[model samples]
Target chain A: MRLRLTPRDPSYFDLFAAQASYLVVGANLLAEILGADRATRKDINRRMAEAEHAADDATHTIMRRLNQTFVTPFDRDDIYNLASSLDDCMDFMDEAADLIVLYKVDELPARVSDQVQVLQRAAELTAEAMPRLRSMDSLQEYWVEVNRLENQADKTHRKLLAQMFDEITDPILLLKLKEIVEKLEDAADAFEKVANSIETIALKES
Target chain B: MRLRLTPRDPSYFDLFAAQASYLVVGANLLAEILGADRATRKDINRRMAEAEHAADDATHTIMRRLNQTFVTPFDRDDIYNLASSLDDCMDFMDEAADLIVLYKVDELPARVSDQVQVLQRAAELTAEAMPRLRSMDSLQEYWVEVNRLENQADKTHRKLLAQMFDEITDPILLLKLKEIVEKLEDAADAFEKVANSIETIALKES
Candidate 1:
């Protein structure tokens, strides 16, 4: 779809898209971290911290843009919510990675990797969807697709959580894994918040 | 401070204040549920559900207002965030109450009541703070006090959880009580979010 030629540039939305892309990159780093042993765990955490910093930087950039740009590609409030929600996704990913690294978890739980992969994909889709918001067209279609992807992530999360509950023996392990899974799942939920807000914006515009 | 006229009429903000007050009312009902004995549990649950229904009505009212209003008394995004956060508090309280009711907890746990009471008071403060947004001219000082109360609630929550962990015996009881305390504490956290947003709004206006 061709981008709508609004009176103002869509730089704020572009910054938001970049923020989400950075989160996807962070999720990939987490996936890579799952393979590292104890010795490399610290280094992996350091790398994850760097990714978090990048996400934070993206957040500040979006905020600054929001302050300066009178005419946003989307609703000003939607831009703020989307920006913060993307940052939250990164924050959760960094936290999960930090816990694994700090606790010296014996092994990377399969569900952790799976959830990160789900988040990575969701972040990608969110980034892709942002540009489309600039166009005064076909947004409802994109909204539906994002909603479907979000629902898929939710289902995958619940399935993985049930699996984790069935397989884990130690109570501490169970609790930690439950938290990680819930956090990742919640990140997807947060993404859905952004999508829902975008839908609101689109409907209002139309 | 005199009430400054808002960008929108009194009805919109009045609805928000009413919804916030409704949540506080739900918190009180939740506290009552925590005080009930096992035999009287059914009655407690019924009252709690009634409170929850009222809270849901408040949420719907706020959402309708948000959708219809253009120029708001405060930042439109902040207004939405405040309403959603307040509704989330109600949702959590209802969930905890429902769980206890379904499980037929033998008696009111001290930790459960402790957290609920703190949450109840915090919600009250939040309800009080909501209307102050209408009068940015007069209630700037009240915003600070509300934040301090929220901070106090957080410290209380942490101390309560620590005491709960240290004092509780019976593994199953410990688990159940822990979840209840966490949910109730989270309700307080939601109140804090509302308070913080109000503080921000106050700062912007002042």
Candidate 2:
């Protein structure tokens, strides 16, 4: 319902929504990889990598459009950051998947599944939030929840680290688990950053 | 001497230079920690923490000024990113030192020092480059050298990982060392980001 003298394209919202949708796919692929057998994990990881590449392509398209577009929905840097952080979510998830296979980790601790569940939940919330960017409606709730979830994820990460050091016998295995868990933690932080960027954009718009 | 209609503040350059100087101090502290005994490293770490807090205060100042000032010399987000990446360099170096003492590791790999050396050089180059932002001169060489150094650091990082995995028998020690090395790598990447940000700012100005 807003009228502007300059024409502002809205497809950027669609592109963001599309980009976020890949995160949902990537997070789900991560969940699937966590449960599958070794052979099955390799297969799932391949899918995750493909999803990551797709996200990468999506990010490239957004950046290219940003370069060509004159008037943007928000600040140009915010768009770049939003796209980069969204890509970060996929990249961290993909890296977690890749390391799981590369290290040949047989079975992860139960808490890791807890970590992935957080990613899945965050991804769903993020995917749901993107389209709403068009309206900038009900975004406060989305960011608040993501912030809460990120805090939960942080506590879980620290406890998981302590638990791993306490229980895991082999140092090499502990190292592998720690790195993967850290990647998941990194992904969670990335999601939190995405929400923060949205909050900034919405605030400026309002 | 180009004439401008609007007033623009240039102290952001000085603030940035001040921030990069802390990096130099912190990087040298890390090198000192590598050579000293546990007690001495603790003493040095105390200084590093102080330096980090100083850098954090500088960042806070930059952000505050950015919010209050109507017109910045360049884009606001680029200033934010530049300040942030500079802070990241200090942060990772601080974390690296903190881990060294926290893990109580007796000795580090020589390549670990190699990693620190790279940081030292980058910090020096970055501090030198901050003042040049006023005129945006010779920045291309700065960023080009930084990119080249980052590539060298990346190669060294992978080799360090393989060597650690191959040589270190104690898994816990390996875990500690790996985390520290990775932090150093993160700092290196952060410097590259700083350089890249400068390049972006310079290009836009040009």
Best candidate, lDDT = 2
TM-score of each: 0.64, 0.68
Off by over 4 Å in 2: A1-11, A28-70, A75-81, A109-175, A185-206, B1-10, B28-71, B98-104, B138-141, B144-172, B203-206
Fnat value of model 1: 0.00
State how far residue B76 of model 1 sits from its true place (Å).
3.9
RMSD of each: 7.8, 8.0
Interface DockQ of each model: 0.09, 0.15
TM-score of model 2 (CA atoms):
0.68
In candidate 2, clashing pairs total 0
Q: Lowest summed lDDT over 10 consecutive residues: which window, candidate 1 chain A?
A: A1-10
- Docking quality of model 1: it rates as incorrect
Q: Write the per-residue lDDT of candidate 1 for residues B1-206, one digit (tens) a residue.
A: 22222234446577667667767767877877766687676776677667666666666566656666677777777777777777788778876776676544566546556567767777777777676666665555555665676677677677777776787665455555666667776777777777777767777787
lDDT of 2 by residue, A44-127 (tens): 988887787778777767876765567998999899989999999999999899888877788999999999999999999999
Q: Specify the highest-DockQ model's number.
A: 2
Q: Model 1 off-target regions past 4 Å?
A: A1-10, A28-57, A64-78, A107-114, A141-175, A200-204, B1-68, B71-78, B95-108, B117-159, B169-176, B189-206
Residue range with the least summed lDDT across 10 consecutive positions in model 1 chain B: B1-10
lDDT of each: 0.69, 0.87
